[model samples]
Target: MVGRGELTDAAWERIGPLLPGVDGRGRSWRDRRKAINGVSWGSRTGAPWRDLSERYGPWQTLCERFARREADRTWARLLEHVQVRDDFVGAGEWRVSVDSTINRAH
Candidate 1:
């Protein structure tokens, strides 16, 4: 069962292939999707990594996987792919919001 903020099977299908595959010489990593779900959950809930649910595997593992993906620009590529596909399917709506107010430190 998909939990709140976790990627659905369809959503995972769209981005799963974009993640980096494990090298045979290195130690095998945990499931990419589950780790990613942990990331999503943590970000959405604004929770600490150490508080991650065991259902998503160890928080440290998820953090490492996320860092590796970010370092490799896999996340950027996945964003581009998803944006392009969503635009093609007429499902994308781009928007930007700016808060122009500046606060001075007292």
Candidate 2:
């Protein structure tokens, strides 16, 4: 059961292969979908990683996976892929709003 703000089946199908361990080289110790959902939940709700719901598995693992992806530029690649796909499919406006006031470097 995919929740609101979580990736849909179609979306996952497109994005899953972009992630590590989908190539059958090695087993992934964690469930990728759940980890991704946890990341999404934290980012969308602006919740601390430690506060992620258990259904997404260990918060630390999810946070680490998110950070690893970020460091490796996976997130940026995913975004670019999605944008291209959406453009080809004629998907409507993909707008993003950022509140810089909440983004102070500390």
Each prediction's TM-score against the native?
0.84, 0.79
Candidate 1: list runs displaced more than 4 Å. 102-106
Model 2 per-residue lDDT tens digits across residues 19-93: 866435344756788788789899999999889999999887788778878998999999999999889999947
For model 2, how big is the CA root-mean-square deviation? 4.2
The lDDT per prediction is 0.83, 0.85
The top-ranked prediction according to lDDT is 2
Worst ten in a row by lDDT for model 1: 21-30
- Global Cα lDDT for candidate 2: 0.85
Number of clashing pairs per prediction, in order: 0, 0
Worst 10 residues of 2 by lDDT: 21-30
